[model samples]
Structure formats: C-alpha cells, structure tokens
Target: MKASVKKGLGTTIWLLSMIIILGGALAFALNPSPAKSIFGYRMYEVLSGSMTPALRTGELALVQITPPQDIAVGDIVTYAVSPDGTTVVTHRVVDKTTDSEGQTVFSTKGDAADTVDTNVPAAAVIGVVRGHIPIIGYIIGFVRANFIASLMLIIAAILVVLAVKNLSAGKKKKPANPS
Candidate 1:
C-alpha cells in the first residue's frame, strides 16, 4: 500500500480503538452491577421527574446501600413501590418511624409533590443516592429498548472492519510479474 493509504488506515484504526476503549470504560463506570461495584456505589437510571431539581428524568444516579438505621429523614432513597418488588421509585424520606411490630417504615415523597407517598418498609429500600450524572441514563435506556437494532449495528461494524483487513492483506500479495 502507498504511504498515504497506510497513514490514513493507521489513523482510522487508532481512532476506532480509542472510541471502543473509552465507550466501554464509560459504560462500565456509569452502569455498574451489584457484583461490579468497585467504587462501592450502585448506579440507577432515573425514569421519572419525581426527584426533579435534585435528580431529573433520564439522569444516572449513584447510590450506596447503607444500613436502614443509618438513613435519615432527608435522605433520598430508591425503593420498591409494589408488593412484587417490580416497580421501583426514588423519593426523599420525609419521616422515619417504627411500626406496631417495631419494624422501621419510611414515609417518602417526591420533591415536586405536596404529599408523602405510601409508607415503604425498610426491607423495600434499595439504596440512598450519593450523586448523579446528567443525561447518561437516556442513552442506556435507548440501547436497552432497541437492543436488536444496536446488535445489528455492531455486526455491521465488525463486517466493515474485517473487509478492510482483507483488502489490506490482499494488497500486500502481488504476483512477481503481471504477464
């Protein structure tokens, strides 16, 4: 291959490598699973504007699973809202009190709401918000919703890379004479 072509291909490969490395690192850092909490914080994607001002919809929130006794009235917590534990919500703890059975119950509310939500048992609480990243949650949600399309795009990218490699390899193999 000509020097100019080699230089162009080298630059393209370097750019692609950098993009892949950085994107993977960013995704891993912002969306860590329970088993991958290197920073001791769990990441959640905010799905509603209930916690607006402090945490907006489409944002990424980092939370830590502190003990129930450690939680204070003003803390923002992620908790399951349904009996089946499928529906989750994030709200500020308005009150903390023990029930008749001496079990701790939390009265939570959205920052934008005028009233507290239904009391949430301590066992239903997932974690307390430590911090948040603006707008990263939208990308994560989109990828999850359109997983098939994303997979197709990834496959297309791999095919393109393989085709380029084959073309370059073929260029390096030429007959001794054209005849």
Candidate 2:
C-alpha cells in the first residue's frame, strides 16, 4: 500500500478506537443505576454458577426489556431479587402463572440448580436475556468498580501511544547525511 494510504488507514483505526474507549468511559461515568438500559438493552454480569453451562459466571448478558405478558416459560430473564431492586438475578423461567390479583408471576430456576427459585412478580422483571459474551462481564465489572483507576490507565495508554508515534515520525523526518 502507498505511504499516504497506510497513514490514512492508521489514522482511521486510531480515531475509531479513541471514540469507542471514550464513549464507553463516558457511559460508565454517567450510569445512574445498575440496571440502566442503552438502546433498549441492558447488560448484566453473571455473578454466580447457577446458570452455568448456559450463561456462565463472568460472562456479560445482554438483556432487552420485555413486557410481562410477552414472557413465556423457558426464556431466560434477569429480575430484581430485592424489593428495593438493588440485587438482581438471571435465570430461566420454568413456569409462568397469574396470582390472586391476576398479576403475572414467573418461577425461575438456574440451569444447574436442583430446584426452582421463589416466584417473581412481573413488576420485578428487569428484562429478558438476549445474548451473552464470555469474560467481558469480568472486565466490565472490574472497570466499573475501579472507575477512576481505569480512566487513568486509559489516559496513560493513549499518551504513551501518541508519544511513541511522534517519536517515530520525528525519526523518519530526519534528513540522511551525505557520506
């Protein structure tokens, strides 16, 4: 490839990478709740082995908001475990039914669990799991727990890359001395 083409390609890649990193950092910083959704999707870090063999611990689960009436048995879902909606759990819906007041209730169980969990109300449902990425949850959890350190590390990495690039450019621009 020509030098100009190579340079342009490199610039484009660098710019794209910066946008991704900075955008992620900004999102993380501005997140108001643990269950906040982006573009109608929410991400949850699988924290236990309950859903193992399907959704493993350390994997990142992508969940999409779904109406209670739309949920069916056998669909994996993430729901609030506490009344305050502070704690969340992801499991497969083993049964679905309506309660005395005609409210939708779902009984969930882990893939590896021996028994099903208590019935969860439709109001507590966060979303249905759409997909997952292995090990990304661990990285995201670490960064979120250490936001300041992660941000500093990212900034430092960017600086080092820029410095190295400038140094190399400077060397390439130096005129060759005639022997």
Candidate 3:
C-alpha cells in the first residue's frame, strides 16, 4: 500500500487558497470598499445630460443595482429599463407610498429633470452613492476596461490548476514509481 502526503508547492498553494478565501470574506464584512480597494460593481462615466449640474458629463458614477429593500429615499440610484435600455438616473426620492400588498414604491426625480419619474419600484434601485473620488473613478474604469488585471488572474488560475493536478497525480501513482 502506498501513502501520499501533501508537500512542497502543493501545501503552499492550499494554504494560500485558504488564506485568501478567509481573508476576502473577513475583509468584505469588516473592511469597506475603500479599505479593500475593491469596487462592488461596475462604474461608469456619466455621458448624459440628465444628471446635469449634479453629475456632469464625463463624471464618474459607481453603479451597482441591488434589491428593492435596499433602496432608500435620497439615495442616488440607477435603474434598468426593459428591452436593452438602461437609465443612469441619479435622483433624490421625493416621496414613498406603500401599496396595500406590502410593497413600497418610491418616487424619484433627477435634480435637473422637470417632473418626478415614473413610480420607481423599490425593486428598480441600484445603490447609494456612498463616496466618490471626483475624477478618479474614470482612471479605475479605464484600467478595468482594458483588462489590466488579466495577468494576475491568469497566474492565479495557473497556480490553482497546477496545484490540483499535482495533488491528484500524487495520490494516484504507486510508491514503486517514485523518482
């Protein structure tokens, strides 16, 4: 009978994976977006006139759509439209009325818009503008668009795959084949 034990790079990779997963989970819960240096969702450069004075064209807006329950009044939110349409509407909540069915409906309108928007179902909200870096979001967006982190991801994938293959191969081989 042959017995195999984890060793060398395999042990290192396993330890690294455990550390990373646990570390990421801890950081995600304790550390904020800034502390972790990770944005929860895609951000875009405002290219529309709707946001106007508040968020001029070319200004960066970090967008992340969450469930209706997360939507709050006065939150700058973006919503998606049906059929390949999307609106980067940044507006304050004017009013909220709950339906008899236990659903909360919020009305929001952009600062520059003429009237309150179509009743924004609490379901349609993205997220609050927690913080901003003025023009800095654009730089981050450009880097992501170009896949600047591609190399890091590729290396991580290779390491994981090699570790898995080596670990499995170690288990299958007979002791007589040791070399």
Candidate 4:
C-alpha cells in the first residue's frame, strides 16, 4: 500500500478504537451503581448461574429501563433485592399480576431452580435484560480493580501505534538523487 494510504488507514483505526474504549470507560465511570443507568441502560455483572442457558455467570448483562407495566411473563428482569438498591438479582418473570394496591407485581424464578421466588413489587424492578456480552464482566472487573495499570496500558498502546506509524512512514521515503 502507498505510505499515505497506510497512514490514513492506521489513523482511522486508531481513532475508532480510542473512541470505543474511551466511550466505554466514560460510561462505566459515570454509573458507579449497578442500579443506576447510563443512556437508559444499566450494566450488571452476573454473579451466579441463576439465569443459565440464557445468561451465564461472568457475563455482562445489559438491562434497559422498562416500565413495570410493560414487563410481561417470560421476560428476564433485574430487580433490587435490597431496599437501598445496592443488591440486585436477575431472573425470569414467571408470573405477573396486579396487587391489591393496583400495582404490578412479578414472580420470578431461576431457570435452574425448581421453585419460584418471592413476588417482587414494581417499585423494586430495575429493568429488563436487553442483552449480554460473555466474559466481558471479568475484564471490566479487572480494569476497575487496577484502574491505574489499565490506564497506563492504554497510553502505552497509543504510543506504540504512533511509533510504528512514524517508522513505517520513514521507510517509505526515498533518498535524494546524486547531483
């Protein structure tokens, strides 16, 4: 490839990668609580095999904020297990009905379990599981635990890319002809 073309391609790839990484980092940083969301979506790290076959442990679950009234049976939902919203659980809604107060209540169960769990009130429901990325939760956990090291690695990667681009550009240059 021509040197100019190579340079352009490299720059484009670098910029795209940086944008994705930085955007993810920013989203992760802004939402310190799993119950909180960024762009209407909350990210939670699956800690158990409760929803196995659909969602596995070590995966990152992407839950989108959905109205409790819109939630239907068979939908996977993440709900706050504690009043403070610090503890959360993801399970499949096996039943849905209106309580005496006219509020929606959901009965959830783990796919691998034989028994249904206690009914969860609408107020405790965080959102519905939209999607998940396998094994990304582990990587995110590591990055969070070693944030400084991860940042340094990202900076080093950028420097290496720049150095390689410069070296390639230099090799593409030709010496001036003898006078």
TM-score of each candidate structure, all chains considered together: 0.66, 0.80, 0.47, 0.79
Quality of model 2 by C-alpha lDDT? 0.87
Q: After superposition, how far is residue 64 of candidate 4 from its true place, in Å?
A: 1.1
Provide the overall lDDT of each model, using Cα atoms, as 2-decimal numbers: 0.81, 0.87, 0.60, 0.87
- Candidate 3 per-residue lDDT, tens place, 81-121, comes to 44333444566677778978888888888778898888866
Q: Give the TM-score (vs. native) of candidate 3.
A: 0.47
TM-score, cand. 4: 0.79
Of the candidates shown, which would achieve the greatest TM-score relative to the real structure?
A: 2
Q: lDDT winner among the candidates?
A: 2
Which residues of candidate 4, in runs, are more than 4 Å off?
Answer: 1-30, 174-179
Worst 10 residues of 4 by lDDT: 26-35
- How would the candidate models be sorted by TM-score, starting from the highest? 2, 4, 1, 3
Query: 130 in model 2: Cα distance from truth in Å?
Result: 0.8
- lDDT, model 4: 0.87
Least accurate stretch of 10 residues (summed lDDT) in model 2?
A: 25-34
TM-score head-to-head 2 vs 3, winner: 2
State in Å the error of residue 15, model 1: 10
Give every collision pair in model 1: none
Q: For residues 14-88, what per-residue lDDT tens digits would candidate 4 score against the true structure?
A: 778896988677567445675566799988888889888899988999999999988999999999998789789
C-alpha displacement of 115 in model 2, angstroms? 0.8
lDDT of 2 by residue, 1-179 (tens): 99767876897799688969787755853575866777988888898999989999999999999999889999999999877776899999999999999999999999999999999999999889999999988877888789889789878988888788868977997899999
Measure candidate 4: CA RMSD: 4.5
